[model samples]
Every structure is written in C-alpha cells, then in structure tokens.
Target: MNVELSFMLKKMLSVALMPWSIAILLSLLALFFLYRHKIQKAKKYLTISILWVILISWAPFANLALKPLESSYERLENIPENIEYILLLGGDRNNRAWEALRLYHKIPNVKIITSGHSLHDPISDAEKTATKLIESGIPEERVLMQAMAKTTFEEAQHMKERVGEKPFILITAAYHMPRAMKLFKKAGLNPIAAPADFNRPEETGYATVLQSKQLKNTERAWHEYLGILFYKLQGKI
Candidate 1:
C-alpha cells in the first residue's frame, strides 16, 4: 500500500478503535435500536457500551494494557560498539531530539538519522529535528534527515536504504519501541532498541479511574496495538 494511504488508514482505525470512539459508536447504535422500537436490543447495547466506557476509563485497565508495550525493550545502560548510526523515529520531536543528542554525546562519532514527514507544518519533522541537533553544536554533516517517511514502516524502509547492514540504535517512544523494532528488523536493518520519552504512570487508584490522563493513555496504547496488527496484516513485520 502507498505510504500516505496506509497512514490515513491507520489514523482512521485509531479513531475508530479509541475507547471514547467505540463507546460513542456503541451508544449511537443503542439509540438507533431504540428509535426502531427494539427496546430489548437497545438496552443490551446500551449496557455493553456503558461497561466498555467504564472499563477503559479506569487507570489500572489502561496501565495494564500499556505496560507490556512500554516494557518490551529496556533502556540500554551502555551504548554498544560498532553502532554506526542512531535512528530516531519521530513522535514527540523535541524530547526525541534531546534524547538523540544525549546519545550523540555518548557516542560522538555515530551518525544520527531523524525520520519524519511534515504534518500541519511547512518544516518536515526530520528537518526540524536535524536543525535542532545542529543548533545544539552537533556538526550539520553528522545529522541525516529522512523526512519522506510518514510511518514506522516507511521509516524502516528509508533507514534501511541509508544505513544498510549497519547496526544502529533505534530511538522512539517507549510504547512504540516494539513495533518499531519489528519493522526495522523486517527491513533487514540491525536495530538496537533505545526507547525514550518514558512516561511512567502514577499508582492506580479509584481517583484515577475516570481521569482524562488515563483515557489518553488508553488511546495511546490502543493506537500501538492497532499499528502492530496492521503491520502484521501487511507483512511489514
């Protein structure tokens, strides 16, 4: 599939699979059934919808879902030898860039590859991140931008072409590391997972059950799960 189309499909699926979206959709269906005078079915659907909303809104539920993905790869305490490049996948740009720069300081000789396409901005994410690295005193020549890639699969493909058969540290959100590693490996690149931007959740309690942050975290976890499934179906990983 075309990269842009795949991205769009992923976005659509994300919204569709989100806890809020699914709840609202189910509620709408319940209402539709009620309008048609199917009272029993309407009540059943409404019950299911409410239960789902409650289940996903709970902090523990979301935390349980996200924990595995976030913990899929632990942070590397020591940067390994012969790592020729540091590939940073785009998400939270500034944080990822900062992490990339920190890695650069540890291994000043390795090239840094920032990958992302433009979204709602004239400056592509890769270019913007590369500029940030340069501004931080890293030589401009050491930063490579793969601004054409809009998704993890595309990022893997582009990086494979640029750093073929070379081992590199793969940097991305901690929750995103698993899928990124799978795609990069499938693309025939040797990737050392270097997950960053870790957001450890607070202890789960009754007060956190309906918190907006928990809801957002649920959405993030669901997005990664959906992305992994999509990649599997497409044979990209």
Candidate 2:
C-alpha cells in the first residue's frame, strides 16, 4: 500500500475504534435492530453500548489505561548545558506550546522548531505554535516552523534533515513521549524527551466517576496504543 494512503486508512480505523465512536456505532446498530422488531437484540446492543461508555468514562479505568504510557518517561528536568533547539511536536497546541515557552525561559539561546501541518484549518499547527511562542515575547527569528509533516514519523524525518546529530529537547504530550522518542531515534536524530500535556493527575480519587474528562484521557491513551501498534507494523519504530 502507498504510505499516504496507508496513513489515512490507519487514521480512519483509529477514529472508528475510539470509545465514543464504538458507543455511537453500537447505539446505531441497536436502533436498526429495534426497527426490524428484534427487540431482544436491540436491548442487548443498547445495554452493551451503555456499559462500554460507562466503563471508558470511569476514572479508575482511564487511569489504568493511561498510567503506563504517561509514566514511560518522567517529566524532563535539568536542561543540558548548551542545547541549541527545542523541537515541539504538534498536538494540543496550547499546552505544548506553553511548555516550549517555559523551556525557552530556562534555555534562552535555544531555537524552537514547531512541526505539524494544517488539517481542516487554514493555518498549519506549526505556524500557530510558532506564533504563540513569538507572541509570548520570544524573538521571531528564534522560532522556526516546519509545517509540512503531518505525523510523528514524518516529524522525525524532517527533524533528521534539520538537526541531525544535534541533541535537542523534544516536546510533546507525556503519553506520546514513548512513541515519539522511538520514532526520532529511528530517524537517527538525537532527541531529549521533554514531555508535556500530562494526562494523569497526582491524586486520582477512589470513585468511578462518569465524566467526559476521564473519557478523553482514555481516548488519548487508546490512540497512542494504536499508534504504537500501527507504527510497529509499518516498521517506523
């Protein structure tokens, strides 16, 4: 299969397999069964859908799915003495951009490289992130934008061209760091993981609270898990 086509297929499959997508698909199937007067099957599908949503949204289950990924690398501390760049991978633009900014404060000499492409929006994520960094008082020249790469593997490929053998801080979500590190290393670039957008809280309560936040965390972790598997099969990591 062509690489771009394969990437799109994987994305579609991942979106279809997300928790909310599964729940919605099940609900739709239940309605179809009801229209056919198969009341028992309808009830079974509906019940399973409800249970699936509840299970995914419960805090304990979300924590269980997320801890392994988020804990793969501890938050980066002790910036290296003379790093030249901070490579901010694209996702959750605000928090990740803020993280790059904070790191810039600590190491003012390092340039920030924002990497991502536009998806449904006119401006690319890389440009948006770079604009945020510049608005936060970082000089325009200090922020670079590589807006063509749409996936982590592509980002690593671009970084290889831009900064091969240079030890740079890599900024991305905490849960995504493990996969990101592997991809960058595969591309033969030196990336120091600086994970941001942490999903797990310090204190998770002992109750199964049904909330969207927990569901979001579960979805994020699920995506990373799927991404790792997909990349492994494709020999990207």
Candidate 3:
C-alpha cells in the first residue's frame, strides 16, 4: 500500500477503535435497534455502551491496562561515553523535547536529532521541535531535523539512513519505548532507550471515579498495543 494511504487508514482505524468511539458506535447501534422496535437488542447495546465508557474512564481499570507499557523501560542512567547523538521521536512534543533538552545537558558534544511530521501543520514536527530546542539554548547547529518520518517505522528507516550503525540515545514516550526499540533495532540502528513522557503516576491509586486523565492514559496504552500489532501484521517488526 502507498505510504500516504496507509497512514490515512491507520489514522481512521485509530480513531474508530478508541474506547470513546466504540462506546459511541454501540450507542448509535442501540438507537437504530430501538427505532426498529427491537427493545431487547437496543437495551443490550445501550447497557454495553454505558458500561464500556465507565470501565475505560475508571481509574483502577485504566491503570491496570496502562502501567505495563509505562513501566517497560526505566529512565536511562549511566550514560555511555561514546554516545554522540540523541534521536528524539516526536509525540507530546513539549514533553519529549524537554526530556531531550535535559539529556543534551548531560551528554557532552552530542547533537539532538528530532523526527516527525504533522498532517495538520505546515511546518514539520521535527523542524518545530528543532526551533524550540534552539530557543531553549541548544546550539542551532546541534539540532537536526528528520521530518519525513510520520510513523515510528518510518522514523527508524530515516534514522538508519542518516546515522547508519552508530549508537545514539532514543527518546520517546515510556509507553511507546518497547515498540520503538523493536522497530529501530529491526532497522539495524543501535539505539539506547531513553524513554520519557511517562503517563502513569508513580503512586498507584484505586479510585472508582471516572477521570478523563485516566481515560487518556488508557487510550495511549491501546494506541501502542494497536501500533505493535499493526506493525507485526505489516511485517515491519
């Protein structure tokens, strides 16, 4: 499939498969059933829809699904002396860039490479991130942009082309690190994981209240899970 089409399809699927979307879909189906006078079917679908929304938004339920992904990789300590670059994959741009900025301070003489492009923005995400880094006091020369990659698989491909087998720090969200590592390694790049943008709280809590933050975390976790599965099916990992 063409890359653009594939990306579009993935985006559509992602929105469709989200918990909120599923709940809405079920509710709509229930409405249709009710219009047709199928009361039992309508009631069944409506009940499931309500339950699904409540479950996904509940704190304990969300935490149970999200913690594993967030905990997959610990923060990078004991920085290797040989590391010369930090490949920061873009998502939650501020958080990821903040982590990269912090790492740049610790790692001497290292260039930070930012990768990602946005469909809705005219400027590529990489260039935007690079500009932010420069404004944050990173030397403009030390910030490189690889903006062609729109997905993790493409990011790995572009990084491999630019860096070859050279080792570098790979910074991404904690939840995304596991799949990011797999894709980069498969692309033949040696990446040391520097997972950041952690979504899970350090202190565990079990609350029955519906929280939007918890729902967001659950969505993020499912996104990674779906990404990994999609990549595997496409034979990219």
Best candidate, TM-score: 3
Query: Over the stretch 1-237, how does candidate 1's per-residue lDDT look in tens digits?
Result: 986786788788778877799999999999999999999999999999988888888989888888999988888768888777998888445377777877888985889988788767898888878888888899988988888877888888888888898888999999989998999899999999888877687687866666777787888888888888988998888
Error of 1 at 155 (Å): 0.8
What's the lDDT of the predicted structure labeled candidate 2?
0.87
TM-score of model 2 relative to the true fold? 0.90
Total clashes for model 3: 0
Residue 101 of model 1, lDDT score: 75
lDDT of 2 at 190: 89
TM-score of each: 0.91, 0.90, 0.94
Clashes of each: 0, 0, 0
Candidate 1 Cα RMSD after full superposition onto the native fold (Å): 1.9
Candidate 2 lDDT, 58-113, residue by residue in tens: 88889899999989888787888789999888843548888887888899588999
Model 1 residue-pair collision total: 0
Q: For residues 26-145, could you state the per-residue lDDT of candidate 3 as single tens digits?
A: 999999999999999999999999889888888887788888887889998878887889998984354689889888999889999988888888988888888888999999989988
- Each model's lDDT comes to 0.84, 0.87, 0.87
